[model samples]
Target chain A: MRTSIIGIYEDEKVLMDAFNRLQSEGITIADVLSPIPLHGVWEKLKLTTRLPLATFLYGAFGAIATFGFLYWTSVVSYPLKFGGKPLNTLSFIIIMFVLTINIGTLFTFITYFIREKMYPGKKVELAVPRTTDDQFTIVIERPHNMSAEEQKKINTLLKETGAVDIIESNN
Target chain B: MYNTRVRGILIKGNKSFSDVSRDIIKPMDDKTPLWWYISAFIASALLIWGVWGFYNTITVGIGTWGLNNNVAWGWAIINFVWWIGIGHAGTAFSIFLLIVRQKWRTSINRAAEAMTIFAVMAAGLFPLIHMGRIWDGFFIFPYWNTRGPLWDNFNSPLFWDVVAISTYFMASFVFWYIGMIPDFATIRERTASAVKKKIYGVLSFGWIGNAKGWLRFETAAILLGGMAAPLVVSVHSIVSMDFAVSVVPGWHTTIFPPYFVVGAIFSGFGMVLTLMIVMRKLYRFKDYVTDGHLDAIARILTFMSLIMGTAYLTELFMAWYSGSEYELFTFMKNRVTGEYKFAYWTMLICNGMIPQLFWFKAIRKNITIVFIISIFINIGMWFERYVIVVTSLSRDFLPSSWATYEPTITEIAVYSGTMGLFILGVLMFFRFVPTIAISEVKGVLKETSTLKSFTDEN
Candidate 1:
């Protein structure tokens, strides 16, 4: 069985400094929970993000598809002449622009949901009740091979890094 | 390196993160305030009365309105334009400010976005009922049907309006709901009641704030903001085309698109200011929706009023320069000197002149004066729509066709009802949710920490 140590931080500055010190000391961080996102923490944690590119692709696809729909419907599908205006005018371009943006934004949201593993009735393990309100929490899972001395050293390091409180639980 | 006076400090000084959370969340968790109840009651009464009016209007047919053959479009279109114009500032606050990286928008965007949704709801009702055949409203959308299935006229600006307004509503609604999920999670965590917790949990979609989650959320928000920014311009432009495409003298002009867009933003700000001033005071959110926000909005209003004044001048200049008798009469005689002259001058004074007072720093800062000016601007915007729709149509080319248009009791009741409905929506938002974004305010507190200290270490 492996045990995990949780540290609750009051200030974001303390949390970031602790994460850096732990990383330098070759301690692995399993997870961090925060009420609001910490700036630059993702880059520091070396997290890879494909959301930007994916959203961009979605936007491009949306724009092309919307433009195609408008063109196909207005110009080819059902063509009509009114007020002697051309079948294809610049006005429908406005409709296409709105639809492109709408679909693109909507798809980006769906991608976010999938990436976050968020959905209705999904079970979430809350580290602490206050984690979503005011507290910043970091979880450090003890490795199976870690010795007693190494575990003691990590405990001292967490305290030294200004953790407001610490809890250890077996998983 | 930071100013001691808190130049751009969104949350007030001397408040910690917990304090920010408590201040914002307290309103939601605590008992509903007496004022909120009173306001909601009034709105409900008005809404009920307006429903009665709407029912009467439907059953009695179009005869309930004073729309004669000449002045076919009256209070319904005017109210529609007014409410839709008010909704513009919400998207402008959330999307435009986000793209521009205006950090201060964090405080007001949530409520402003709510205002957008409610105002759109109010505006949308007018057009459906204006049809006099509200049941056939679905015919407006392009859909396949069994009968010869008459397709929508894509060229007609009215059809364009249906598409544009509906798109604006959906986009704004989605944007508003998604942004609230994180906050909903916070509320879900903090609340003691099991039912409330469960409801909020579902609404939040099990949001567990992690670095990866935030990264994706930020990317999505920025993309959505980019998409919504153009909508603020395009929606109003399409709505203006509804009038511009017509051959009516006052309504038809190339400048209507830009003119209406600017006017929509201006009126939208006016309504936002009116709501925010009261909200900041009632909700005790003075710390978040600070004086700096008011000053910034006032300055924007003043600048918008200046452009609106210029646009008005351009219209007059074009009317004179066109050398067309109808355009000249619509601008010079019927609008300025004829029966609807009161409305015309009121629009000029309210929309064009009153907002200039905001140019003065003292007036902009004075809450009382700002409130008064906002009311004036709101009145002026309604009158502007009225002057355009009524005066232009009332007196056409032939004098025999000229007839004065007067709104009946039913029209007035319906308009007032929409007002109540808008207020009711705002009240419900205040009671159910944190009027300010709690997480964003904490973020601002971090960003503004430099203002509290003179240290260069940060």
Candidate 2:
């Protein structure tokens, strides 16, 4: 069995301080949850994301595909003379640009949901219910075989670093 | 971050994170207000009237409208452009302010975005109903149909309008919904009702608010905002191209794109001002949407009004300088002094001149005065479109085509119905959602002067 320890704080700064102190003491933080995004918390967690790159890639593909469709339809498939305007022209750029945004936005939206393992009606079990309101929660998981002394030291550290409450559970 | 000393405190009254959430969610949690019922009843009545107009339009056909042979595009197109211009407000408010890092937008953006979605919905109805055969609307799309040579003219500005408006509507919806997820999650955690909790939970998409989620959320917001900024510009520009691409004397001008864009922003800000003023008063959002925020929007309008004035003058100058008799007749004769002179002058005073009152600090701070002026700006912008659409088309090159246009009862009903729909959408939004973005307000709470010491310690 693994034990999960949750430290709850009221202020984001105190949470950040507790987070930094735990890391310095060689404790691994499973996650930090808050109502609003904490400044520098993602960086502190050393998490890297390529969502921007994904958006760009999606946008490029959309632009190319949109342009190709426009060209094939207007130039190759069914070319009609539009008041002496060329069969293929820059008018396609507007449609291409708009479609690219639609694709990039929609694809990135789906990507974010998939990456986060989130969906409508997904049952969420918050470690601290108030984590979505005014509270900040820091979750740490450790083996149940860890000594009581080590657990007490971690609890004391959290309490001293401004954690209002600490709860331990085993799964 | 820049010094907070330079800007007014975004959220007033030294708000805490819990306070922000409680204050915002209180409206949602409390019993429905009576004023809402009254307003909603009025809006529904208007909507019913509008539905009658639409029924007549669909059943009776385009003949019910006031459109003549020469003035084929009357109130339908004019109202379409006007509503589309108004739709620009929410994105303009949220995306532009987000890019520029204006913290003041947090309180007002939710309402503005809701307004945008509703306004766009209303705007879209005109073009569909104006088609006379609403079922044939799918023909606007570029699909592989059996009609061998008719694949939705990829070169027509009208087709561009369809694609651009649809994409814009979808993009704005995505951006608005994405921004609301965290707020919805907050509502889910706070609501006492089990059913409400379940609904908000589903709406929130099980958002956990972990660092990784915020990381991706912020990245996605910026990406969407950057793309949407240009999309908003293109949407209106394409709508303007629907006119400028034509050879009509008043319509055919190289200046239409920029002129239309500036006019759109000006009118959008005008409508935002009107909605926010009423909202702030009704919802008692004085603490969140402070006077400074309204003043900022007014300042933007004042500046845009100047550009509008300049654009109007530029059009006049171009007409005289181009040495085209038709252009001169359209500008100086038909618009400036002819039968449509009332509309022309209404546009001039409402759009080009009325907003100049905001240059005074006293007037900008006065809520009643500001609200009235905002209404005038909206009316003025409508007249601006009217002058562009009706005045030009009513008196083309041939004197035989010179015939005045007036909207029939059906056209008037459809227009008012859209207003009713817009109001009802906003009222429901207020009743259900947190009018002020709770999380965003909480996020900015630390930046206020009262909390300056708190941030300094961090």
Candidate 3:
């Protein structure tokens, strides 16, 4: 969305090093993209993620609500007995447990998709086409307060850390 | 720490991430193979025939099948249990293996998961046909009827089955789709056609391979896997309850739940072996689906066969020890030396004795033998369900009403039709989706230090 220096690296190791170096030097990196997910990159960038926490909460809520709903339906709404079984049975517990898991799993996945803004028909602009294949890319949005010397230093650092190509894009 | 080689090298030939992507994505991009189309054509023909059989059954009434008042649960129930059993291996491979930290599952999990979805579809068909009045099949659901305001009996195992099975299908579908997202994104990047790209893009949901996204993806997979692992056990257990809850002597075993679960995994691995052996050969995925994967599956199948064999013997021992006349009659008289003794003995040999061949290293490693054994196991599992359902029901407490059961042409056609539908689903899946999870395969490739060393040497 803003003018950014996009650095493309052929290898994940070099891209990670350059990304950490830039983060350490106090440069605000817009994002790093790679063919495969690079784990620990968020911790390396010192960014806190709430996705896992959100998933857990969503699952818990779903399980509780599903169990409650099953209880209300079987006990409160319609108290019909079959084969002289009690109002509540151990078999209902198994059904309730499975429903909780089913509902919880579906809810967690849906919430993850929604929170991540991942949905059908969303257009994604690839900064580097090869980022989805065999390359890793780092995008650094230029700060208005940065001096020319600092910009030059960042460019040299990216090149030294094995960036095969550097492109300044307005995309 | 170096025990990654315990299962042998998952991927061979020093394949890099790019290599993995290319190999997986090639089938998607390339023209459909002649064999694929030929197989699809034959499957389609059989599916059409099965549909006609189903139509005839519905029109001609329940009398169309070999089912009677006594043998009410016939081929339909048998096929239902058989399909459900076949579906279990996929979930077991994906979820149980993931929980246990078996990384090699990544290579074959996608296709196996797809098989689960299709097998469940096949399983769902039998109950519908068995209903006879399938138009009123919605009665199985919990929704309030607009006409008579009928309410479903939640206490019924059949009702629980309706809930469990649909839940199982939806859960497996979501889990499969979620796992496919990143790989679909890769396909989006690799494709040349705009239409294909757009389709894959939407399916991928704008995956950017960001750190946060990856973390969420991994977390979600684990969560879904954890939920699915239990479901894989429970769905089959509930299916087993359809029999166990009944007072039928042979069907009312306390061991049905765990026994069914183990048999499901055993037969499931058998189906997986049957499919994967052919798939690896056809797709040339020897490097990814390597001998280690086959060996591991064989070992599990062997273990399951032994468990199943023990369960079979336990039924006999229970029958004799309980001294219940009916139970003893079902096992000793009806099953062992009864009219259907041939079917009983075949089940014993196919499901029990045949898988024991895998105990030998050479047989486990032999693709041809594994394939043949897997086919026999599938047949054996089918007969096992038949023996349980028909044998127990055909000769119940009353000796006056005893009659031998045989499946009619319509029933056989419908069963054959489901086979066609299943093969068609697998064929379509192979042509379209990435049969192997490319990203996960790449992840495993990165984790394998042995591969890293090999690449380093090169």
Which is superior by lDDT, 1 or 2? 2
Off by over 4 Å in 1: A1-3, A169-171, B1-7, B147-149, B449-458
Query: Between which residue pairs do clashes occur in model 3?
Result: none
Best by lDDT: 2
Tens-place lDDT digits, model 3, residues B134-243: 89887777776564444566678898888788888888888899999988888898888999999999898998787667767777788788888899889999999999
Complex DockQ, candidate 1: 0.54
TM-score of each: 0.95, 0.97, 0.95
Q: Per-candidate DockQ versus the true complex?
A: 0.54, 0.70, 0.55
Candidate 3 stretches with Cα past 4 Å from truth are A47-67, B1-8, B146-150, B449-458
* Error of model 2, residue B187, in angstroms: 1.0
Ranking by lDDT: 2, 3, 1
Error of 3 at B280 (Å): 0.9
For residues B36-147, write the lDDT of model 1, one tens digit per residue. 8888889999998899889988988989999998999999999999999999999987788777677778888999999999999999999999988888888888787765
Q: What is the per-residue lDDT of model 1 for residues A20-70, given as tens digits with 9 covering 90 to 100?
A: 998889888887888887755777777777877887788788778866766
Whole-model lDDT, model 1: 0.84
- lDDT by residue for model 2 over A1-171, one digit each (tens)? 667898999998899989999999998898888988875678778888899899999999999999999999888988888889998898888889999998998898889889889899887877677888899988888775878898888899999999999997562
Decreasing TM-score order of the candidates: 2, 3, 1
| Candidate 2: residue pairs that collide | none
